[model samples]
Target: MNKWLTIVLCIGLPLAVGGVSAYVTVQNIQNWYPGLAKPFFNPPNTVFGPVWTALYILMGVSFYLLLREPSSEKKKQAILLFFIQLVLNFWWSILFFRFHWIGIAFIDIVLLWLFIILMIRQFYRVSGKAANLQWPYLAWVSFANVLNAAIWYLNH
Candidate 1:
């Protein structure tokens, strides 16, 4: 594959995954169980879309930077971790929205948060720029984890 295409794929594929996850999350929010109570700090529903869109784009850029690196065993491991986190990323939305399992979603996001940290560390080893690009994503996921925990706590 062409190098540019590989970069595009690295970015675009994750963006596509994030898009699907966002769609499912929105749909689920609209259909959320009526009795469940949200926390006081829960932002209005309007905030999620734009916030996630930016995060997903940042995530793609981070991955694209990593792809620009010369191939190596470490690069390969980083790429593997990248995909693993992406899969976990999508599953968080599914667990929270589709399955309506708040506790499970909390568990999933905690795991996702750890994977994101590992990915960032690995990305840093390959390309400092790539790892730096991931900081915003890490911050967002950290906030999301707190939100997820609050949701689980309040709803239960």
Candidate 2:
């Protein structure tokens, strides 16, 4: 595959996932979300879109860097971990916003966090830069876990 095309696809994948998740998220922000009990630390709604966009870009870059590494068993494991976390990331939006399953969302986010950590560890083994790129993603998910927990506690 062409290197540039590979880069585009690497970046595009996470952005696409984020786009779909955002679609589900946006649909609820107006009607269903505002009614929820939120923590004092819950960020303004406007913060999410840009933050998520940035994070997805970072994730894509990370994936790209990982892919650039020589083929190896560790790289395959890292790639698998990345996809697992990405799937978890997508489902969190659906669980939280679409289904109004706050508790389930919390569980999903926790699992997402775990997957991210594992992904980062595996990414580090393959490419340090790739793992480094995941830091913001890990940070955001950490905050999200707190936020999800707080929201669940407040509402339930």
Candidate 3:
């Protein structure tokens, strides 16, 4: 693949998936979401859009770094972990915002967090920069897990 094409895919794929989740998310944000009991730690609603967009871009960049690795075996494992986490990330929005399944969303986020940690470890073996890029994602998802748990507990 050409370098530009690789970069585009690296960044575009995650953003596209995020865009899908956001489509489902916006539908409920005003109606279903506002009605739920939220945790005290919940950031203002405005914060989520920009933050998540940034995270997705970071995820894509990390994947690009992993993809650029010379070892196909290492790339394969990291790519697999990356996609697993990305799918989990996508489903959290759907499960929580679209279906209003708070408990399931919490579980999904936890799994996503774990996958991200594993991806970081795998990526570290391929590219330290890729591993480092995932740290903020790990941190954010860790925070999101706590937030998801608190919301589930509070609203249940």
Candidate 4:
């Protein structure tokens, strides 16, 4: 496949998944989220959209770079872990926003953070840039774990 196509696929898939995740988030942000007690550290709702957008794009590019590696069992495992964390990424929003399961979402975020860290390690062996790309994501999710814990504690 052409580089352009690869780039498009790399970026497009994550954005598309993020768009779907946004569908679950937008409604709750307007309705349910406003009522919840956010941590003092929580930023205004406006921050999340842009931050998540950039992170998702970075995730896509990182995944693309990883995928470009020679096919190997390690690559396959890394890819699986990548998708697993991505699923957890979307599921966290749904669990917190849509279903209103704050405690469970907190747990989910912790697991997600761990999975991201593991993926970073695995990606490092494959592509240094790809591994580096996940750093912001890991940092954000680390902060998010604290936020998630605080919110759950305050609310429940």
Candidate 5:
């Protein structure tokens, strides 16, 4: 396969998933989300789209770099961890925005954060650059966890 095509496919996977998640999020933003009690530190709705897009792109690049490594048990583990976290990532929008399950969403984000940590560790074993690429993602998710917690607290 062409290297460029491979890169696009890798990046597209996350972006495509993000698109679906964004769809779920958009559905709520106009009707449901505006009603929620958010933290003072919460960013405007405009901020989320660009932030998430950049993070997903970075995540795709990290996964692409990880995929360049030779197949090994560690690589396989890292791949599994990536997918697990991605699924968790998708579920967060549903839990928080669609279902309005803020408390459960907080729990999901915590588990997602842990899985991202494990994924980054495994990515390091495969490719340092790949692991490095995930830092911003981890940071954003960390902030998201705090935001989720605060929203839960404020509402409940």
Candidate 6:
């Protein structure tokens, strides 16, 4: 595949998936029971869009950096982990927002956090730049995990 195309896919795919998640979350937030009772620390609804967009872009850049590596089993594993975590990210939003399942969303975010750690380790092995790119994404997810847990605990 062409390099630019690969770059675009690395970035575009995650953005597209995250965009869908954001749209769904927005649509269902008012209808979701627990989300309405979120803690004061819960950012205003406006904060979510920009934060998620930046994180998704960071995620895409991380994947793009990984793709620059020469083909290898390690790189392949790293790429796989990247996609896995991305899928988990989207699932968490769907569970929390659309299905109104805060508990399950918490579980999903925890697993996503673990997977991100794995992906970070793998990215480090393949490309330090890629690993670095994931830092903000990991940090944001870490915060989200805490928020999810809090939401589940408070609303349960």
Query: How accurate locally, in lDDT, is each candidate?
Result: 0.85, 0.94, 0.90, 0.90, 0.94, 0.86
Predicted candidate 6 versus true structure: per-residue lDDT over 1-156, tens digit per residue: 898888888789888998888787776875664336677788777777788888888888888888888999999999899889989999998998888888999999999999999999999999999899888888988989888888888878
Please report the TM-score between candidate 3 and the true structure: 0.97
lDDT, candidate 2, 49-141, per-residue tens: 899999999999999999999999999999999999999999999999999999999999999999999999999999999999999999999
Tens-digit lDDT track of model 4 for 1-156: 998799889888878888887897778879998898887789998999899999999999999999899998888888999988988988998898889999999989999999999999999888899999999999999999999999898898
Give the clashing residue pairs of candidate 4, or none. Answer: none
Candidate 5 vs candidate 6, lDDT winner: 5
Alpha carbon lDDT of residue 31, candidate 4?
95
The TM-scores, one per candidate, come to 0.91, 0.98, 0.97, 0.96, 0.98, 0.93
> RMSD of each candidate?
1.7, 0.7, 0.9, 0.9, 0.7, 1.6
Name the TM-score of candidate 6.
0.93
Clashing pairs in 5: none
Better of 1 and 5 by TM-score: 5
Runs of candidate 6 with Cα error greater than 4 angstroms are 33-35
Instruction: Give lDDT tens digits, candidate 5, residues 1-156.
Output: 788998998899999998998787787877998898889999999999899999999999999999989999999999999999999999999889989999999999999999999999999999999999999999999999999999999999
- Candidate 3 local Cα displacement, residue 32, angstroms: 0.9
| lDDT of each residue in 1-156, candidate 1, tens digit only | 797887777778877998888777776678784456877777787877788778777788888888788999889999999999999999998998889998999999999999999999999889999889888888988988998888788878
What's model 5's lDDT at 69?
Answer: 94
Q: Which residue window of length 10 is worst by lDDT in model 3?
A: 66-75
Worst 10 residues of 4 by lDDT: 20-29
